[model samples]
Target chain A: MSDIRFQCIKVEQLDDIHVVRFADDKVMDPARIEQLGGELQRLSDSSESPKVIINFSDVKFFSSAAINKLIVLEKRVRAKGGRMRLTNLRPEVRDLFGFTQLDSLFSIHDQQSDAVVELTTK
Target chain B: MPADADWIWKIDQEIPSRAEVACGLIRDFVEKLEDAGWNEALVFAIHMALEESIMNAIKHGNANDESKLVRIVAGFTASLFQATVTDEGEGFNPADVADPTLDENLEITSGRGVMLIRQFMDDVEYSQGGRKILMRKHRG
Candidate 1:
């Protein structure tokens, strides 16, 4: 009854990269993280091994659970010789990454195009 | 700091459905505290503590069984907010939980909740039964 729905996850193939954009409230809710993990796992299982771009512009709050799930997704992507990038992070959420010292662990970009450029160049 | 600002509430645990209702009640309580001029950090700390305690009661104490009961008690003073979550299940050994900070466990998913609670709360105390946790946070 909470009406807690996750943003739509759109997977678009940009050449060899997969751009996964979350289009809903980016709050850290356990149920939403589980669903996101499921989707990421499905994509990772495929043989294409595309670069992953997680667009976080729509997310406002960051939770430890969501961060943990992101770490899992990062590991999965790395295992397949692919890289994970985050883009369009709000300042508050970005501060969370900084607080957690995860800024060094993942590639972050101010714009989606910048993330795309980084992935293409790599 | 106003006098007579302290408040307390207690409820028994049920299924996640009932647990959610408890969460709602706690959320309302926190909102009321915020309206009373409690700082943001204390409010956030209370919210986190409440969520963690309720989840532990529902998942670990009741083992997700609807029949089991979990109890939560919360109190706030002018300088500190305290909460206790107790479950009906046979308690767990806190020492048995692996150190989540170790490099080997960094990628592991499950053990981080307790670590987060410890980090976020100013004080954390566990009873031998392993079913009860008392957490507190102070206002800055």
Candidate 2:
């Protein structure tokens, strides 16, 4: 129902869950990734027990540095008792997460609607 | 670059340790691979591996010092890709890096770059006390 803008990510609010998507096809730049981390952190901190769903439909490539940012964001969301889910990860990026054994730590969904339903139902 | 050639495009250069320079080099490498008709999966692997290696050299190794230069030598055939990245900064031992996969370290933000390079590249070795990294990938 609402929108928030960041240079690297697009935010859309569907009721209580915020659906976030990358504005760039490739989220590789470290400096830009930092900005993205900051923006996501701010959003997580904006509400009590924020429910966020990160949609990766637009991201084709992202560096390991970008992965680091996501990990940091997850920690921030958790510290605030918020929930975060990642959906629509491209195969390469998804494989990277598996390689690092982070697939167990993060909640990943193959579709955005699944994540939204899960987050909302919970 | 030829599709059937043993080795096609190759380059050796020392560029300033800047993100933009590193990106430009990666862009050129990907373009060469694409021009030679490399598959999307293989291209993605090489692109991800090179991006991590070169960026690590510039950001971590050189500490973003623009005066410092990172040396890169790369060549590829239709089936194989190889590259070496060397930075001027004092290197740390790769063994000392904590495994990010461990539960205790899962929340850590950094230290995943080296692991990614090793995962994507078929052969990866560090020399010059980790200041230099050699990576090779075989096309599938």
lDDT of each candidate versus the true structure: 0.69, 0.86
Question: Candidate 2 lDDT, tens digit per residue, B21-120?
Answer: 7888888888899899988777888999889889889888999999999999898976789989999999989999899999998888888888888888
Off by over 4 Å in 2: A1-3, B1-5
Residue range A8-107, candidate 1, lDDT tens digits: 4677778777777774553434566667777667776664565888888777545566677788888888888888899998766675566445677778
lDDT of 1 by residue, B26-100 (tens): 667677777768765556556656766676667667777777777766667666677778888888887898976
- Per-model DockQ: 0.26, 0.77
lDDT of 2 at A108: 98
lDDT at position A53, candidate 1: 89
Model 2 DockQ class: medium
**lDDT tens readout by residue for model 2, A9-101:** 788888888889998887877678889888887788777888889999888788888887788888888888889999999898899889999
- Segments in model 1 whose C-alpha atoms lie over 4 Å from true places: A1-29, A43-47, A55-64, A86-117, B1-5, B8-42
Q: Which ten residues in a row have the lowest lDDT in candidate 2 chain A?
A: A1-10
**Model 2 Cα displacement at B66 (Å)?**
1.6
* Native interface contacts kept by each candidate, as a fraction: 0.05, 0.73
